[model samples]
Target: MSSLLDVEVKETIDQKTFLTFDLDKETFAVEVEKVVEIQELTNITPIPNAPKHMAGVQNLRGKILPLIDTKVKFGLDPIKETVDTCIVVIEMEVEGEKTLVGTLVDAVQEVVTVPSAEIQSSPSIDAKFDLDFVSGMFKKGDKFIMLLNLDKTFALDEGDAADNKENQSHAKSKKS
Candidate 1:
């Protein structure tokens, strides 16, 4: 029974549907299983002393969801909201806790099923952008979509550090 269950789990992991989206005109994908839902751009309350990448927080069905600007996180210019702009709500484990984070994308594309076999390891290069956030690359026709490791891409420790620095700055300012 255990062996059968293992095989089933392996099969499930071998191929997964990914939610594709556009960031800075480039295609990117995140595993669909992590996606909670997609939402239209709405009013987000600015968080005091939050990181620059953090767009702010939104009230989602009574829960405050933190929003991350994907373009800013990727070290690109912040996106100018358009009709196509939307948020992809994703649930990820942060510091062993399940957290829901909204990722702001330029636009969302259709979901696509990609086999794990087809994903090629991202090449290590000395680029301005951090490649650790990328899990792999998927080729579709003439374009290659970057597969993002959502967990690593939005690590809570980085946010915490940013918050701490902001708080320290605020405290120093108040003292003056």
Candidate 2:
């Protein structure tokens, strides 16, 4: 009885769980082990002179957690916050320290269990944003969900993000 239930729960030996979210119509996922929690969109204190991709900071319990706009970070246009908009709090390693950052997503999908063999390397293709942050991907139904490398995607280098945006703008101007 009890043993049977335990065996059923332990069936995912070769499977990993991921927390999925949506931005625009594309889907993205991160390992559930890296996700701390999810919260509905809350009042965010805007930071002065912060990078455009940064949404600002929010109070998580008693700690101040910085928030990043996932769409903006991926070079996608930011959409107005709706009822489905929420924050996915993820634990990332930064400068040898463990830190928590809240990422804003259009909507959270659900936890999905994927077999290890199903995950594939992302193909090199022209995309709106750099695919370096995508660690892997897997096709589901008619859509492919990219798995994000939390550390790379949410690196807390404010100056580097601003510099990258500036450099991209310069390149675009030069092309004109």
Candidate 3:
């Protein structure tokens, strides 16, 4: 009886739930623990002098949430807005601070429990864009879902931020 109990506990530990979503032609998954909530695509106020990858900011239940274009971040062209388009609110640790950011995706699919044994290492492909964000992948039927490393995928470099700030200040000074 003890051995059976041990097997059950181990099996539970070995499976992880992931929230899968579509980004263009590829499907990606992120651990559900990091996901906060999903919001339908709404009016996003554009930020002045922001990076190209930043879609803008949205009011998520009175809290301001920064929206990021996942397609542009991955070096893919932005997808047209449709009824299925939505924002995936994720909690990511950036520079030791927990920040809530919304990522725009083509669509959100069902949540799936994937076993650890089925996950494979990221493939070494000569792709146009960097695959450093992908931690692992697993096959589900005919399609494979790439597991994303949240920290790396949504990393904000301090240098880039500082530069942008400096440029903005300089522009303001020039206008004055």
Whole-model lDDT values for every prediction: 0.88, 0.86, 0.87
Q: What lDDT tens digits, residue by residue, belong to model 3 across residues 1-176?
A: 47988998999999999999999878999999999999999899988867667889999889899998988878889767999999999998777888899999999998999889999999889754468879999999999999987777777767448756876888799899
* Candidate 3 error regions (>4 Å): 158-176
How well does each candidate superpose onto the true structure, as a TM-score? 0.85, 0.83, 0.87
Worst lDDT run of 10 residues, candidate 2, spans 156-165
Taking the tens digit of each residue's C-alpha lDDT, what string does model 1 give over 15-132? 8789999988789999898999999998978877777788899999999999999888878898789999999999998878899999999999989997788899888987556798
- Note the clash tally of each candidate: 0, 0, 0
Worst 10 residues of 3 by lDDT: 155-164
Model 2 misplacement above 4 A = 1-11, 157-176
**Candidate 1: worst-modelled 10 consecutive residues by lDDT:** 155-164
- What TM-score number comes out for model 3? 0.87
Residue pairs with clashing backbones, model 2: none
Q: Residue 81 of candidate 1: its Cα lDDT?
A: 95
